[model samples]
Target: MFDFDEMESQNLFLYLSLLVLSITFFFQNIKPRLGRFFQPSLETRAKAAILSRQEVAQFLDSPIVKEQEQEQEEGISPSSTFDFDPYMETKVELVNKALDEAIPVGEPLKIHEAMRYAVLAAGKRVRPILCLASCELVGGEENAAMPAACAVEMIHTMSLIKDDLPCMDNDDLRRGKPTTHKVYGEGVAILSGGALLSLAFEHMTTAEVSSEKMVWAVRELARSIGTRGLVAGQAKDISSEGLDLDEVGLEHLEFIHVHKTAVLLETAAVLGAIIGGGSNEEVERVRKFARCIGLLFQVVDDILDETKSSEELGKTAGKDQLVGKLTYPKLMGLEKSKEFVKRLTKDACEHLQGFSKEKVAPLVALTNFIANRNR
Candidate 1:
């Protein structure tokens, strides 16, 4: 008496029970292992925590955090801590000396003196240093890019002079000193600006790089200050001034900054890369990085203008408000503007990936310095 049906039922039950046990074992043991395998390590979590802030503060206060978080997330660690202050000091000295040599008190001493006054003033020298740093980042020597570096600074000084004219923003102070038009008559200041613009191209041609690279650098520099770049931004800015925010919105404001501010920064980096012999891809990468920081620079400027004192800013603080101009803080609120700063800083640093940490230190440090600068 085989009891065939009962025997079949018993086998089916046994099979079901074993399958259930396997699943339970997987959930209890193997699943835990799998979860642990997928989870990020404590070190990774700690690194990520660098970007977290419990309280909303000005973005400049935590410049190191944004840069460090970006680097650590990419598993990048410099061999040693990068001392940015000394690095900036060295670069500033180099640029200042070059600029002094570039513009001597020659014939027509008034224009040259005005040019020298504006160019040799105590600027952050952000544009020129960016050129040098970018050149070095692409394996070019500093000396090779020195000419272009000085050229970029000259263009920047020209813009500042023109920007402070009675027809423009009409500011009385710049770089902690009287505006160019204030010290020198507006006519002479205007002439000095024109002279610098011409000298910038001439100085750029003096670079010992190939003619092709020199041509490319010259084209980029011209476009930056032309109708396509700074001029475009300034034109829009002047047109939109005192208009209702609804009429001139964030998009409009961004257009102004992208041209008026970021264009030259983009040019500075692109010129450096070209002179440094970087490939097209590397040049574009640096361009993108500079664009982010360029816009970031304006956003930070807006924040500083709203919050810092005139003495603290080295320029007229609250001038944007005084002039009925739109700013990031006015449009996005201070907290949101700060958040934008963080985002821009993050984006800026991310572009530096794939380059050696040591080689890219100057640019990275520059980004942080720009982010955290008090003046």
Candidate 2:
């Protein structure tokens, strides 16, 4: 039997849990609302909804933020700001080392080479860094998060390779060099991408956390790339290729961005929180925070594509416009897109209101990075 009553009961329970999480925030900031949504992962019983506008002027401009601002202006505790450069450099180095060690240039040389060539390519390593930061935010050891961090990067690299194949975006340059399919044959790129995807699951299984956490992280990474996550978003985007720009509205755009970009970031934070042994509440908080920034990341990319030159972006610029693909900038002009980015980052900042300011400095910095990065 399907047990419809039990399912309804579970859904009601989830809604109540979400209400509990938001009650305090709702009191201070009535502008933003939260909900409960099912996450398509074995590890996630449910994921919190994204925030609506939270009236940043009312919330972030509180007495506490004003006091901090005064302190910064007076040169008292100027270092209160997060040191994003050094933090990113350290996390990237550690993640690169782990990725290199995980894949060796050994037997079956061609395939291994293809995998390494793409996996070791230049990029921000943002997903892995976010994973490590999320772990440390919850007082977990970096080593405990390393395996999952590496897994996220592996999966991301695999997506890049797949996206660049002839049948897909058909791009020639990624990271300022030829894409995987451009250098290696299409057959090799496909096989190598699959190999990296498989390795992500295998490598995640080696996390130093408890077996339970490891299993949770593994399921998260898989779901992030499967039908309900990145693939789902990409499928929708492809289907929308021929639709008129006016026909694609905010709802569809949000859907594509949420599933395609936000899901990986969501899984990264959730996995980190899991390995760090965060309480269910803390994990859900970080997941909600990451979801906003993940969407911000794509919105910024859309803006950059319209505003910057190809040389500045290190790849094709205005490519989204060329393909008639739907983008935030296209759907809502540059000014509105910029406003949307601000709303999202402010909402992201709101999720960390209960965490230690010191512990969440990196996430705060990441929100700024997403808002301001030129490339």
Highest lDDT among the candidates is held by which one? Answer: 1
Query: Which residue pairs in candidate 2 collide?
Result: none
lDDT measured at residue 210 in model 2 versus the true structure, 0 to 100: 66
Q: How well does each candidate superpose onto the true structure, as a TM-score?
A: 0.80, 0.81
> What is the Å distance of residue 128 in model 2 from its true position?
0.3
Q: Which portions of model 2 miss their true places by more than 4 Å?
A: 1-81
lDDT of 2 by residue, 1-375 (tens): 899999999999999999987986786555321111233342232222422434434532334321221111121121365688898888889999999999989877888999999989878888898898899889999998998898898888888888888787778888777888878899999999999999888888888776656655666677788886889888888888767975866767877878888889878888898898898789888988888888889999999999998778877788778878899878877776777776677767877777766778887787787778999
Per-residue lDDT over 100-169 for candidate 1, one digit per residue giving the tens place of the 0 to 100 score: 9999999898999999999999999999999999999999999999999999999999999999998889
Q: Model 2 misses residue 151 by how many Å?
A: 0.4
Error of 1 at 175 (Å): 0.9
Return the clash pairs for model 1, or none: none
